[model samples]
Target: MTVHLVGAGPGDPSLLTVAAAELIRQARVLVYDRPSMDAIAALAPADAETHVVGLRRGHRALSQPEVNDLLVELGRRGDVVRLKSGDPFVASRGGEEAVALQNAGIAVNVIPGVSAALAAPAAAGIPLMLRQNSVTATFVDGNDDDEHAEPPDWHALARLGGTLVILTGRGRIRRIAAKLIEGGRAPDTPIAAISAASRASQQVLRGTLSTLPAPLPPPVTFVVGEAAALELTCTSPKAS
Candidate 1:
């Protein structure tokens, strides 16, 4: 038996890769995370066995080790699909699972999907790169542990020109923004806090380094840069 580790994209079901959709259709046992669960689960066959490994802020339904064990257990029975939000390799622990599965002699297939680092900004009408505004794009994880473990070098990041996309930064934006400002980033640098990106409930909050809204909802994507201020004409209302 084989297991497929798939990225479910940034919430918009239509954004799922063609291969991801096909795998869901053929899956006999599906393991999924919280984001975009309803939409992705619907794509699976009616008889498919589903296991929800609820992953949320402040609450983890299943530990990574547990999920990996479950995948190994399920793979031996039938085709298992491990559905994760965003690109399976980005932030999602699909790589760890793949390693575990491989060690157990189970075949693994990885299907890449759109990551929110780029999708969230585009969906919110914020271009990440532009000829004049920005020349680079950088992604950083703002999870709570990030400040203590493998913290980003805000001073160096400030010197690098481009866009900064922070994922899982809802609670750390103020502190992180302050650090960036202290690192020489302008206090008035444009920033956008995008919540529920690409979903019907999506919301984009625009402000400067010192003016971003407090307590932004979880699962937010923060875009900070000159490019964050440019709203392209082709952006749709649904992006808001």
Candidate 2:
């Protein structure tokens, strides 16, 4: 009777909220994002109808319109669950889908989950904030604009002096970091590229803007801040 917007929480099934998990297990029509991974799909009840919209691309995922249409049509059925990767409300464009369904006279509910902006960095042992360091946190989506995208207004963020987490920012990482540097952030500012976050295969690469050209894995998350530098001290020493 309701169209629920559920957050799959980064990539870990265990991170899903109890309510979100319940909604998925009880769902009969599960419209999901392929990026959500097998761990998330396993949550679906045995009898549910699962639609793997982005299966072809692996977890890179579906176009917004396709995901929107699926959610809206499923809503018309009166009991559908629109599953999202990471917290549905984060950079997820969940609001857009919710608005579309509501405009079509469909009731909607949101079940929150851990967002990559937070989980990714935490997995690398980088606290987004600390008492002696950053006191505030700002989350930005690094969706590049035309021409490889203009970077975020790094000057403004530099002025604010807080923790910065950039989501969907893999492609624009170098640009974003450069902008922040030009905007007055330290060139040695700490950065962690957390990819496939929260999963067993998750990888974290720590570097400064000067050393960022090194190789990295795909589907990554970028966390930028002076606080991020602590990742070195926070991480457990590796075996010889």
Candidate 3:
């Protein structure tokens, strides 16, 4: 049996790739992370066995090791779908799970999807790169908890000078902003926070390194750079 690691995209059911949708539809067992993924998980066959391994109001959250063990056990039974939000590898534990499954001698397949890092900025009309303003884009995990991995170097990021897309950084945005400023980024450097991107509830808040925007709900993607100030989607006539 093979376990399919599928990207459910960024909170929108319609954003799921054709391959991802097809796999879910045929899944004999569906495993997903957050409760927010219910919409996409609903695509699986009604009889499919479903498991939620992440945080839920009444359910115990599964640790990374527990999740990997669960996937391995499920993979031996039948067709399994491990649904992850956004792209499976982008700031996600999907990679670790994949490794565990492979080491257990189970076949694994990965399906790519649109990451929120890219979608959020686009939905907010903030270009991650502009011809004369920004030529690079850097993506970092704001809530990284890997004990073996070194923490993000915020100071170095500020000095690099590019579009910075931080995933899961909503809670620590203020401190992050301070670090950026300390690293030489101007206090006026534009920043934008896009929450629930690509969904009906999507919200975009704008500010700068010195004046961070008010907190939005979870699942926020933060864009920091000159490009964050440009809302190309705005139709208002520009001052000539």
Candidate 4:
């Protein structure tokens, strides 16, 4: 039996690849995360056994050691499907899990899916790599508990004029922007907040580093730099 690490994409159900959809339909047992799992589970076989791995707000989750053991144990008994939000390996910890399974002598493969880092800005009409707007880009998870204790070399990113995409940063956007601006990013540097992107209800908000909202951004994805200058024409930005 093989272990399949699948990507649930960002929200829109139709975005699941044809192969991934078929696997979901045939899986006998599936393991997934909470709240985010419902939409993807709806596509699973009616009789599939579902295991929910709930992560409390800022609380400890199933330890990686526990998860690795579970995969080894489960893979030995039957086929297993490990579903993840967005792309499996895109900052979702799926890679680490996949590696554990492989090291345990289990066959494993990852199914690619749409990631919010790219989809969020697309739904907002912003090209992450616009020829005229930006030459390079980087992505950071702002939701990290210690995002900037020392911080990445903002000076380097600023010098190269690379685009910065931040995910899970709902709480630290204002501070992040300040650092970038201080390092060299213009205070007026273009910034956009995208939430629930790629779905019918996708929303976006555009402003400058200096005009960010008071409460700061959300678990949403952030796009900054010249790429922020792309003329996004998808859904209009929600009123601030």
Q: Pick the candidate with the highest lDDT.
A: 3
Q: What do the candidate models score in CA lDDT, each in turn?
A: 0.84, 0.78, 0.89, 0.76
- Mind giving the per-residue lDDT tens digits that candidate 2 earns over 1-240? 678889888887877899988988888988776644667877787878888777555354567777888787777876998887888888778888988888888899999888888888877778887988888999988875635446567678766767888888777777777788878888887777888877777777778876784546655788777777765334322211
Candidate 4 residues 96-215, lDDT tens each?
Answer: 888888898999979988887877877678888866777677877675565335556655665557678887777777777777788888888888888777665566677888887444
Worst 10 residues of 4 by lDDT: 231-240
TM-score of 1: 0.90
Q: Evaluated with TM-score, which candidate comes out highest?
A: 3
Tell me how far the alpha carbon of residue 185 in candidate 4 is from the true structure, in angstroms, after superposition: 1.0
Give Cα distance to truth, residue 90, candidate 2, Å: 0.4
- Which ranking of candidates, highest lDDT first? 3, 1, 2, 4
Across 134-198, the per-residue lDDT of candidate 3 in tens digits comes to 99999999985568789899999999998999998877888888988999899999999888887
Q: Estimate each model's TM-score.
A: 0.90, 0.87, 0.95, 0.84
Q: Residue 5 in candidate 2 has what lDDT?
A: 86
Per-model clash counts, in order, read 0, 2, 0, 4
Whichever of 3 and 4 has more lDDT, that candidate is: 3
> What TM-score does structure 2 among the candidates reach?
0.87
Q: How many clashes show up in model 4?
A: 4
Runs in model 4 deviating more than 4 A are: 56-60, 143-151, 214-219, 229-231, 234-240
Candidate 1 clashes: the total is: 0
